[model samples]
Target: MGELRLMKGNEALAEAAIRAGVDGYFGYPITPQSEVIEYLMSEKPHERTGMVVLQAESEVASINMLYGGGGTGKKVMTSSSSPGISLMQEGLSYLAGAEIPCVVANVVRGGPGLGDIQPAQSDYFQSVKGGGHGDYRLFVIAPASVQEMSDFVPLAFDVAFKYRIPSLIVSDGLIGQMMEKVELFDPIPRLTDEEVIARYPWATNGKPKGKERRILTSLDLDPHKMERHNWALQEKYKLIEENETRFELIGCDDAEYIIVAYGSSSRIAQKSIQLARKKGIKVGLLRLITLWPFPKKPIEEFVKNGIKGFLTVEMSAGQMIEDVKLVVEGRAKVEHFGRYGGVIHSPEEVLEALEQKLIGG
Candidate 1:
């Protein structure tokens, strides 16, 4: 631990990027996440760590910049809210197809189209289930607290590089705006160009001595070649599913009901668990940390252990519940409770839903 300080989640993410030794950040400001770039610019990371920070003209340009930087094997990142993220989709698809490593943080606000500046999990489908074209998936991490907002950045980068894939930190506006005590970490040194070349020979850093020139693109006109590429991507996703599913179980040991939620919804579900416990109702929480790899096995195991039912609490109209239903597979009852378009469900409201749907039935 470096030092404990009270900070907003967006600020924590910015500071963590500096400490993570990121080489550059290219992003356009968006609500609930503008603080990330604002903090970076104010801190003048270039003076301290030779980091490059640019306020791109648009989200499209920012994501393309990330694609360029990441193709060179640099640890680059960007942050935006839902609408801006939508603008970056095509670039994100290109990054994925090129197999570049980079981190993206979506401090999501409500949206089908610029719905509100308030917290919402409406983008759950977009984040977890490839928002862009092609058969690809992002390693999505959902942070429920200010502390996690800071912590997941480095973790996202580490995983992104390990697999040569894009990683995403999926947060809500509430977490981004909320202030809480967070313990910062010591700074890590950024890798030099030589180091990056040595580590990732596949990087587009020009042809080295006796090495062939690297090519980075998503275009494959040949049908057979494109099919092979798709197969390879699927294999990578399978490996990630096997090795990278992360989740947190709270009070599940003796509970009869499990509430599945992630990001800000998980925090609210925690309070709901306490409320249910006071009424002698055996309730627990299953907080998903990795949304892309979709922690399915744990839910299956809980069902096997005679867990009664599952209620997915979200800020959207039950996007994640579909995954839960798929995993549960009629082994146990499943339900969804949500408030869409920036309306956050209160603890008592969640408890009421749980009681009415899972316990009462």
Candidate 2:
């Protein structure tokens, strides 16, 4: 544990990344997330920790830089908004195929085009559902507040390395721009290059004294080899889903209305739960920490425990609500409430949605 600070989510993420001993950051400037780059620029963390920070010409170049650093078994990261993140998809998929560890933060905004700089969650599906292509997954962490933004950086790195996959801290403009009281933790120490190479010799740094040539690639020309790689990935995914599930349950032990929300929407949902409780609605919250490898079993268990219904709220066009519906499996009614195109709905609006469906219906 280090100290407390009132900071914006974007600033906290950059500061926390530095504290986490990240080896590098490579990202193009995109609103909301640009503060992350600015923080790194202003602090010059490299002077203190010899961390590398480079603002690339494009998202493409940034992700490639991340790829190069990752090839050397170094902790590297980047951030972008929705469209910019979308552009990085090809690199992300290749990284997944190669089993490279990295972190990508998507400070989401309205989508399908050069959407506004305001907050939105339209990237929900893109982030969670193999954004690039070909049977892949990013270890997704959805942070609901500035506090979680600060806390999730080291956790993201740990998970990324533990699973040897790309990890994401998925947030939106509201969380990115808002100021909050956050308690920062002491930077989680990470393995040095020598230590990492000792453990993961496959990393492509350079051939040493008697070591053989090392290659970093994802291509498998033979069908059988590709099939084996896919199977290995499947096993890794299973292990991750089984062991890496994380979420927050509020009054869900025995509640009639369970609200399923994540990221900034979750903060509003939490406030809605408080208000709903005061009004005698037994409302609870299931805040998703791990967006991918979705926390299904616990949610399913709650439905099995006689929870009547759930309100899936987000800033997207009911993207994740579909997953909630699938997991709920008709045992409990699942309804969705959202505002797309960067328009943020207030807590009252969410509570009203809950009132119509959960309270009155």
Candidate 3:
């Protein structure tokens, strides 16, 4: 094990960014997630790792800052809640279209519109289906534990740089506020200006002599050129889908029914699985790790093996269920169960839903 400590999810994530060698953090404080910026401010990473931490005037400014900095091959990121994230959609879209490397964390709160400062997974559709206006999808990760919240920052940055894609870590108030033990990774070295340019030739850092001209923009006046650019993006997304689809299977081999969930809901489902198994119900858990490049292949495999049904559990009324439906394609009986208004469901509630919605429905 490396460095280990007990910490809140938001603080762990903040520290992980420092160790991940992040160049900068530009964000406005929002509930639950505000702790991320607060921790960074308290730590003063400027003194520690030469990391620049700035409290942007607004979410709009924060994302635009990312647009500017990320285009230069810098590892910059931000965190926000539901309403705050909504304000950054246009900038997020621009970054996606330009294929800039960056990370975003959404410690979600209740919302269709500033609902509350409680944990919620209501942003599933907004996250997976592309929150911003466009046909682009973020490289999305859903952390089920404080450990994951700590670890995925580096992973997101690595993936972002590798593919020149923006990554979104889909966390929530539960994971953000909860405290747990996390083993932190050793610090990575930040890239120098020359190293960044050497590694990422597409970056428009400066007009360096004897180097290729690099233009970073999401604009195209000619429709035909734009069509080609869109096609190229679609091909890249397909490639990511092939290589980066991530999920987990637990107690699934002999299971007759399965519970599909991600992030916080997956943690609750593990207990539900235990309760179900004790009652002689053969239920298993399917945990989604990557939300965008969804692990469709695993679900398809389970369905082919003739699993009776699947129950998609979430804090939202019903968002991820649509994806489950799309993946199962009506072959298996799939239903949704959840609590709305920032209320988290209990294990008993999940077990009950499995019986009523999947097992016996």
Candidate 2 C-alpha lDDT tens digits along 143-225: 98898898899899888988899998899999999999999888655568788779777788778888689877789999898
Local distance difference test, each candidate: 0.93, 0.89, 0.92
Query: lDDT by residue for model 1 over 212-280, one digit each (tens)?
Result: 778999998999999999899899999999999999999999999999999999999999999899999
Worst 10 residues of 1 by lDDT: 205-214
Model 3 C-alpha lDDT per residue in residues 44-158, reported as the tens digit of each score: 9999999999999999999999999999988999999999999988998999999999999999999889899999999998888887887797999999999999899999998
* Worst window of 10 by summed lDDT in candidate 2: 185-194
Name the runs in model 3 displaced over 4 angstroms. Answer: none
Best by lDDT: 1
Between prediction 1 and prediction 2, which has the larger lDDT? 1
Q: How close to the true structure is residue 244 of candidate 2, measured as C-alpha lDDT?
A: 90
In candidate 2, how many Å is residue 108 off?
A: 0.5
* TM-score of each model, paired residue for residue: 0.99, 0.97, 0.99
lDDT of 1 at 251: 97
